[model samples]
Target chain A: MPQGQPEVVPDDGLTTRQRRNRPLLAVHTGSMKGKSTAAFGMALRAWNQGWSIGVFQFVKSAKWRVGEEAAFRALGESGAGGPVEWHKMGEGWSWSRKRGTEEDHAANAREGWAEIARRLAAERHDFYVLDEFTYPLHWGWLDVSEVVRTLRERPGRQHVVITGRYAPEELLDAADLVAELTKVKHPMDAGQKGQRGIEW
Target chain B: MPQGQPEVVPDDGLTTRQRRNRPLLAVHTGSMKGKSTAAFGMALRAWNQGWSIGVFQFVKSAKWRVGEEAAFRALGESGAGGPVEWHKMGEGWSWSRKRGTEEDHAANAREGWAEIARRLAAERHDFYVLDEFTYPLHWGWLDVSEVVRTLRERPGRQHVVITGRYAPEELLDAADLVAELTKVKHPMDAGQKGQRGIEW
Candidate 1:
């Protein structure tokens, strides 16, 4: 809660402790960087608290493994903290099928949404990261209204974080927390290129 | 690069390969959450890459140790990756002095900035997190122009990430990458209390 936090009363009729324990729907969207990075940061926080983590990447290739994915996957497999289940479009969402066109990508996005909707209904994980999920709604591959409804009605104390640029209005309306990252400047503007450790 | 990456040519005439190796001055600011969290997330990335990390917090009291500090400190002390030196205003910046009233806090912030300026001049760490550094500048406790000049002319390829709301224009102008986080919705607005794992 930084600035202009709306005055909210106890509308849910829950005790403070109970309300603190409730699940959260968080959206990270905008033109600047770190939307997915912030979502993954929350996942790291949640995982450290022994919460089961589920990560679903919508756009990145299966071969494109970011460092967070590697660290979380390794930490999850360490048999010390909560286990993590990671899925990507080419891998779990599309059943390892090759996709080269917009149509196939749209279909996979839909498939991914369907699976996530089912998991939300089932309350499979304590924390769910829908990394770069806004693109499908922005692209009209998934119905924004339906996505909002499903997330708003998601079951149990499962926290879900969706990240991408151009997040739909309906989704924002339904989210419990929303961060719109605006760009004030960028390294590329200065002709400085991105490196693997810092950029990825 | 996400949406609307500025079309920038290499005005410095450096090769893309050469530009890729240069470190950056990143700023996360505005009236929203995830500013510091995003900076900490980058620290995680840097830790994984074996880059020595230094985190300096200005506004938050030293008693308030966030989860990232714990994790990074643990990783740093484990004799793995690179070292982490975390300093808050109350700890390293206050010169072991008792703090009371806003004047003392302001003085501590100024002292903290002086130490960090020296560190930046010395190129002590590969990656630096100036958490909540903008508040002092916004409050006129620190000179924004001096901060910008020092950061712009800091020695070595050490990447610096500064986080806070209402970052001064001069700092943003000097930054290599800037993210302005905008508030859309917040749990505090819904009267949902913050818990340790999620909020910290």
Candidate 2:
């Protein structure tokens, strides 16, 4: 070896080091069918793979809605055990109903969105699900461009999943995968009634 | 009985139905989260209660994303067996993605939304969940006010669930329930690995 030669590093350490790759996933469902259920299945698959997950449901408040916490706990209790943390939009639908001043509602929505964005940026969850994110854009409560930009700028190797009927084109374009559910024939067409464990 | 009294019918040949007191549920999860699983659970609960149901999804093209048919089958296979049908948005998301072509995207989105509105107005289903409804809004692909008005004008005892992050205040105001999930902790924070069954 030359006197001035630098010591060569062993390849073992380099090979053993883990590579991080975070993929953004957007699941767009067309209609009332089963988009949510499908998204859940995919998440379950991911969770089963030993990945820690972060769950977010937009446009949701704990007052009138059945909380995802119950559902998450139920999922865990049903033998789909794993450590899953949940983050929820807390203001509920007060803005949509015009229950409060526009300023108040706007403030709440902004606060909620900021929290979501912060979490998305700060955490390194293996998976992040933004549930019902499209409504803000649909109702003119949030800027779509900002959302797209934020999603594009998300840090870490976390995988993102979005589910809803009308996904914006920008989001779909940026998405690696998109799934749409269509309506063909339905029971209501034939006057059949919706039953429990089937239509809830 | 008085001679002028009308006969009291026990059941006007219509099946006794229970009103669905539950709020409509919509979920948006990016990419590969368990949205479908959650939808399936909700559907199953509603189905067991004897309510008519309808399902639809928006697809840009037949070849693009996973079709609603597969999702329905998967949900059903996962024990959500019920009378659920899937519909496609027909127009894909690509047309909306093209910049400077707002008219085309709007037209397609309107057409798709018209179909949804028609179904909602028909009041055939007690619960309606628009999976990716926010995409069109985010892309400037659809008119948010129009969609909200249509939903607000929907008749009967129908409960609607619109899931997606970034829902506007107008839509949120129109909703009876709103939920937002915030992320607190995650496994990826410490560099844990993601596997197939857990993070798919």
Candidate 3:
């Protein structure tokens, strides 16, 4: 559990309820697994609460069959809870002329950030999960300062969760909740590969 | 983002299929939230894969309403997939007469370990989630070496995930996957309380 609290409270003197309702900006980083998985779990909770959810994935190929994506999509289509929009920014690699080039990835990243920024301004989703988003910021493909400013100024009750290793300092400083997943140990150190269902 | 691979592969030369069929022992620990939450998220995935699930909460109160518990229980009871067994070790606080002191928690912890051991021996569930289990080992209430040995020698394809802040060295060494969640930032320091849906 996080033992440290923000040292100072806002001058507004918000009540517990108000603080609870306020959207949180969270960052899940560090070199370990479950960063995206944990954020997805929060999305599940948000969906259960009838909050609209949006998941934007980067780095990971769109073809990656993450079980959570299928499960959450089914739940959304079932009409049993809030709607969910899952966008995979790494869907296609066939850029032809610019195939496998850094510029291609950079352009796509910038485009993805632009979309997220627009949605944040519009408050399109109650909960926004920017899965592996820190990579773009770290690679300098997307402007970290711009992202910090946009996320800080996002409207409504939009809770944003960004996950990726080597998160920049600017994002961490602006985030209300940040959890860094450290690798205490892994089977791969013993020669095991990532397994299905578990790794996915 | 772990760069290290297991130093050597076993002489057994197991194929991908054989390896994929094997169970995993994962530990989620450290002074940050989402240890159990990530484990539960894995449970959600396991449920989707038609794997039976067992969740044992060692420290949290039974009366506590965790969103994952309710969600998983509902999924279990729905009969759409595998069943789930939810056990709360700290259900009642009134055992002070014969127990309830530090010793009481230790006794319960031992008993809980025994039950889990029995079930693991019996292969009761494909996925077992030992939530907040590290505290007992850290507290000397449960023997770390014993737990490590038990996990190492457990039979069948039953996967286990243990979560707590101060995980024991023995358990970490035995675990195939271990994640340590570090607290980078928190709202509590600002006097903000944990919120519904997000926290629970």
iRMS per model, in Å, is 3.9, 17.2, 4.2
Which candidate number has the best DockQ?
A: 1
| lDDT of the candidates, in the order given | 0.77, 0.52, 0.76
lDDT string for model 2 (A1-200, tens) is 00112134333333212422335455555765555555554555555544566776664444312323444434443344345666555534322343343445455566667766776788657777667766665666778789889888887666787877577777776675566654433334333344334343
Query: Which of the numbered candidates is closest to the native, going by highest TM-score?
Result: 1
lDDT tens per residue, model 1, A166-200: 88888888888998878777777776656767866
Model 2 residue runs over 4 Å out of place are A1-22, A59-69, A76-80, A90-106, A191-194, B1-12, B18-200
The docking category that best describes candidate 3 is acceptable
Instruction: State in Å the error of residue A110, model 2.
Output: 2.7
Which DockQ values do the candidates obtain, in the order shown?
A: 0.43, 0.08, 0.39
Question: Considering DockQ, where higher is better, how would the candidates rank from best to worst?
Answer: 1, 3, 2
Model 1 earns a TM-score of 0.85
TM-score of chain B alone in model 2: 0.61
Model 1 chain A, TM-score vs. native = 0.88
